[model samples]
Target chain A: MDKLGVAEGLINRRKLLGLASGAAAAGIGLALPELVMAAPFEGLVERARQAGERQVVVAGGTGAYGDLVKKHFYLPFTEATGIEVVPTGGGYGEKLAKLKAMTSVGKVEWDVITLSIDSLTPDVTSLLRDLGDCAGLPDVASQGVDGSCLREGVMFDIGGGVLAFDKRSFPEGQAQPAGWADFWNVKAFPGPRALPNIGNPWWALIAALEADGVSRDALFPLDIDRAFRKLDEIKPHVTVWWKSGDQSQQIFRTGEVVMAMLFSGRAFRLRGEGIPLGISWNGAPLDAAFWAVTKAAQHPNAALALLDFIYTRPKAHAEFAAESFGSTAQRGALDFLTADAKASSVLQPANWSNIVRVDREWLAANREKVLQRWSMWIAS
Target chain B: MRAKPLAGSPFGGRPTSAQEYGPGLSLLLVTPLVLLLVGGFLYPVGKLFWGSVFVPEATFANYARILQEPLFLLVLCRTFEIAFVVTALALLLGYPVAMAMARVSGRTAMLIAACVLIPLWTSVLVRSYAWIVLLQRNGVVNNALIETGLTGTPLRLLYTQGAVIAAMTQVLLPFMILPIYSVVRNIPDDFVRAARNLGAGSLQAFFRVTLPLSLPGVTAGVLITFILSLGFYITPALVGGPGTLMMSTLIGQQTTELLDWPFAGALAAVLLAATLLLVIVFRRALALNKGFKLG
Candidate 1:
């Protein structure tokens, strides 16, 4: 009887495993349509050949950004012009140094680069091609003319740093923190907090001052020393200094900390995942992630076309925005957003209005000094 | 003309070119390895060390900056202190476990050995996450503690220095154990028997006869654990608070966030120098120990 019972159990276990395998196979089968749809874009290679353009290498295109560039830019460009996008992502300084190093060695590999203001601000004038030359191109000029996108490189997305909190950790009917000031306030709320482990301590410092009753406009002529003092007070309370957006979400989900400073879209993703995360847009600093053609690009025209395509395709912009939790530079891009995407994203005008427009040029120039002081201050 | 063929009677075989070509052959065999070491490791390290001082016009500014800042010294001291404590803990825990494994017979010993290695094989990140789950307020350890009436509340175990030490020790203990195990296994039974014949107690025999013989392995384990602990980033980052941030993480932030390669390289050079110095000192001390010479 025992032997028979064991055999029955074995048969049931096998059936369960078989069911799991079948489901996995079905998942692969479901993805086949998307693969088939993307297949036609391969014609871009022949088009590129006909146009006499060689392969183009797209640097810093490895992450989701890289994936997007490949799908929307590389594949289409290859079909249209025959150039290939090579994806490479590393630390911004390291990547720039590598590019610089390659140029010095006369072995430049990347044809295009997608960089943020933080990356392109300092030496970008030298590293990047003057897309200004391509200003006559309608799509390029249109996308590139947006307030944050700037005069040179085209802005692809409006990303920012926002305060994210776990709603469940806070009491019901209590006022949610509306900004950085409230994020640093511990006594009233009383829980562990996490902060960004990187970047300007300036934001948190500003938040601390605001918590102490300083206004937003007073941030400049920055009581740099006073900000450090303010940060020092709150430093002990931070449980985890999160390194990445994903780490921030994980911290929230695991209840590692009640609140955190996070990338704007991560909070949206957490809410989608059913975590009770709330984004407080008040005093959120807006940052821009822009794309530019590398000086060494072999297919600058196709790269321009890729940029134009992104600007012109409202649907694609909308889809990217919906997935990434940021907004497109195109004015009417929000019309395509789903209700769920709009409700959670920081892209809405109301949220965008609350964000302080950061002076990227000033920030970039003084960033090194600010960071050194911040690191020293944090350790102290 | 033969001149006794240069008296090649050292071996029965005829004189071969290999005998005369020993140095050249050795150089040929070692050249690739040396080139690899120089190109892959030395060049980067040399560049870092040089850049630290040279970037600001051959100034000692980087070194001076480190000295002038109390935070750097404090972190460096704390890092060494933590590494020392971790090394002591690893030796304490690992020595007995290794001894037990060496003494025990059959499948159970192999199973325990496998269990130790299993954790080593698993991703450090995965283990750290598991630790977070286990150590959280509502997690298994606290729940068990509460249920057993050990405490009225769950102790905060996830983000303390204790947590960092505990996690670090767990991760580093295997490195300490394997070397000691190899040494302990070779300890002849007759030595202990001989001690017993001299009317020494079992504890005495262990302390005098057995212990000193195991010093080489213990020394090796200490070196491994100490050096490994110095470079620890992930464990402390996951299980520790702001105060627990180490030199490596600080260097990482410098590169990724500040985009300050020169400073990052400087910090790395400092850490590398400190570790190398410690290892050298440790080797000299070990060499002076008389038992090690025979062992």
Candidate 2:
């Protein structure tokens, strides 16, 4: 048996050697220099043209905000122009990376990209076309927001990070915990908690400070270490550190935690799901996502047009927001929103009023410093 | 030279005639597979190595930065530490299971094998989530422990090193068991019986005859589990604490969050090199075991 096994091993080794040599030869034969394939992207664009169909690849078209993009932007625009919309999911940084990659290689993937204020309003100035300078658009400065709003991107919705809790868990009709200070009071609320794990320590820090009795208005030039220390105090009490919006909702829905700091849409969804969740609008961080035209868009005109058309129809915009739990950029859209939804919705004008608009300029200028600090905080 | 050799042989034997050319022909046939492996696996690995050394615009900045960062060093060390613990635990858990499967009779052994593989067959994410349910503060395990007066306070199990090690071992045990089971199942009972006949007790027979022979299987299992454990990202990330920053997670953050491609690539290159070195060491160790059959 040993001799036979030895013979078999020797045969297998010899066979392996033969296979290796043949594979090497094949490799040499097939190393025909790849002519940097551009055909797939080009083919999709060409097929759309040949079919007499306008093509639009809309980034950030996966979640509720994305669903709004589908219903309001793509569905209506496609009906108007006989175009097909390719929906893709990517946040601002991902979209920027992709846009940069495409422009570097000269193969544009999307006609339009959605970017949040935190990502788009900075470093992406060169990659975006000047939408404020575009003809027949609302001059944002005239409307009192500024050139910062009008310069490159169009804000389609007002979204923010908010505090939410399971109402069933605290149903004594107790004095409502107004802000982050109350959130930190474990003795009063006394249940497991959940917090975001975005790697951006801004919200976490902000919540920590708020919990430690720092007023919202006094939160500028944020003392990060103090905030971290406060978080350290509360860290053991937090049951789940959620990574995604959906994960936040799952934590809440499963009753895994009684209270959580959640994204607005996720909070809205939980409320809609009859999970006895309440959204506290106090000290919410307002960050708006903007629609921008990519520098390398094949249909730049169409992309801009789509962006404009989304803000034009007030009734449709309201309907979109109502369904999506997101408020539209249109001024009159809130009037069309139902009283019950407007009361509970963070997207409402009243809700938006309390939201502290994050100065992206400050964040953008200090992106590296902030991110490094943030990373330190998270791992620490 | 030996043209007149065999008078009674089926075919008259000359040296050239006796040396069949089939083996040489077979060697010629398998050259393509070699080329494929070289081109596919080796080429990419070569590229990664080159990327590590020759930073874009030609600088060793990435490597220098990696060395300078205490976090990077710490994480890398932790990754290996986690991998070692996971590998040890898997081996400890898997050996008995594999032995039982090897020693037990037909359907029962098969059923045990199925149970071993059921976790492997499940999605890794699903398994990690299941662990989350099992290890959470109010989870089943905690509830049972509390009810049984094991502890008054709910022991914090979720997002801990222990949880990560446990989950990782559960995930990787099948890899260890399957290879060991194959080797153990084939080991003839005669060796053990012979040992017993030589005045050795049952335990002595197992130690002398069975254990030495089963080293090949155990070596294979350990090597596989170690390698798998090193690259594990999702399981560790989901089930582990903040301090459990593994190499893959760091690579992910560098590429995805930090957008530092060169740094990410360099880290990846380091991981690949480490993996290769460990595998080679394992192979050499196995080769030195002259008593065990290589196959």
Candidate 3:
């Protein structure tokens, strides 16, 4: 019995090696320098068929974001490639924990994962495989996607944290809050405000600094002490420090706070629901969510193919952005998007100059210290 | 006559069916459970302690940082404060219900038991959300307050420290009630009756006799509720605002948000040690109190 078991294990191991080699051959065939420039998707489906791995698992954010990915990205990818895409929904933090556990156990179950700029720290990046040449997708470069993609991951969608206010509080014709300064001027806006408690506090800190009259250009290497001091002025007025997207939406829906620094996507959804919401693009911090493969992924080739497929497909990207109320990372994607969709996006041409870009690298490097200090400040 | 054979007939002083199996056999009977406890509980906790010292290279730096950091210390103290408040509130509210449960018989007791158990059966997340719905600015409570002319403006009730205490007390009230209920229900009715007959008033009888007899249950309830509340993350996070930062929230931020496992483990170790120390002190207090004896 023991000998039979050993023999079966050997056979299985040999089968795995054979399949891996086949996948590698297909990868090389598709990745040839000559063919790479003309049509990235050419022969990709056939190559996937020869690759032998039939499925790729994805870990992504839940709720509307998860649904959009499943409908517009994963389902389409599966239809084109014949490789089943299993998408698991979770918060970025939960996904990170699961990835760490799986990698530490010498078995990684996920091939692709969605990561926030804050979670793309050095420790997390170390566990991810460099996409090599796949990192430089031409579509991504032309789109002016957040630069963090050039370093560690592939940017898929761009969103921002905007100062969203209930229209009931700031009625249609009345003077409305224009920026962080007005958000802080409670006497002017005159209602409780909400900020995020989860993730890095860079958005809040930068907004605080900007409210304190710091220039947009001088926001990097944030003055943490001064920012916290500014925050202290508004602390007593903040009714909710929401930790989840759903919670943020609920707070707005329930009128828990008259105004909140909320994700633009959520604000759009709330407006669609007829919630009488207003979003301010001034001093809004643009945040991009990225897709990266794990180091120990069993299907790296398939994962890369999926990443490339999503990045290059403008129509799919547009649809994803529209449905998710986010902006696509492909330049051509904007052409495909409706004028209304374009107008609503954080990356709209008119709104672009007013928004501030969050420095991902700086935040990643100082995440620990910033988190400790933020916790202390919040408690205080 | 014949000394009543010591109540066991011809087998007086002999080993009964229960004692037929020796202590060794009894230990063997429970070996699987012991092994499970060691393997599942002790092993992971021991690993957590080891990880605290060894991760990011072997050192006591994590522990030292936690000790030196005012934030960590403050969070720990705040955690205790919230837990104590919850425990006290639960006791205050739960004692009367438990006393009523003990006093009542049949259908009424079951109804009260069902009332306590139903909430306990619900998920903590659902319960916290319920509190949010009830306590938000324009929620039911505020709407009622406004309609009744109690106050023109809605009071801020949801995200304050008060919300954390109230929600936690609601979630943990069952833990406080069940232990006290079980103990109180077992107390002989004759003791209270005898006190009443001995010319003591009803209030005096309860304070001198019923309360003392139920001290063991009160201790158990307080200890369980306090310890459980110390590790409460979901309820507090959901219902409370940033000001209500607890130790569990810090540890969660470290483990999940920051991915600083070593610091998280260190935080967990401190919380675990503090909980165990408190439990020991509580047990010692109970031991010193000769009036109450727990089974």
DockQ comparisons of all candidates to the true complex = 0.25, 0.16, 0.61
lDDT of 1 by residue, B1-295 (tens): 2123443122334545555568879789889999999999999989878888887578777777778877788788878888999999999999998888888879989897997899999999988888888897677898899999999866678877888899999998899999888888778778889999999999988888777877878988999999999999999888876677788777777776656677778888899999999999988887787454345
- lDDT, candidate 1, A43-145, per-residue tens: 2222343456665666654677667656654554444333455567765566777878877787677766666666666566587777665443455454432
- The DockQ assigned to candidate 2 is 0.16
Worst 10 residues of 2 chain B by lDDT: B9-18
User: DockQ score of candidate 1?
Assistant: 0.25
Top candidate on DockQ is 3
Instruction: Flag regions of model 2 displaced more than 4 Å.
Output: A1-67, A73-113, A126-151, A292-313, A347-350, B1-23, B136-139, B143-155, B276-295
Q: Highest lDDT, which number? A: 3
Residue-wise C-alpha lDDT for candidate 2, range B115-194, written one tens digit per residue:
99888899999999999899876789989999999998777788778899999999999999998988888788777888
Q: Per-residue lDDT for A104-184 in model 3, tens only?
A: 999999998888766667799888888664534444455454453545568777678888998888998999988999989
Indicate the docking level reached by candidate 1: acceptable
Q: Please give each candidate's TM-score.
A: 0.74, 0.77, 0.78
Task: Write the residue-wise lDDT of candidate 2 on A143-166 in tens digits.
Answer: 212222546777766667788888
| Candidate 1 Cα outliers beyond 4 Å, as residue runs | A1-63, A66-113, A120-149, A291-316, B1-59, B121-126, B136-138, B146-155, B250-269, B280-295
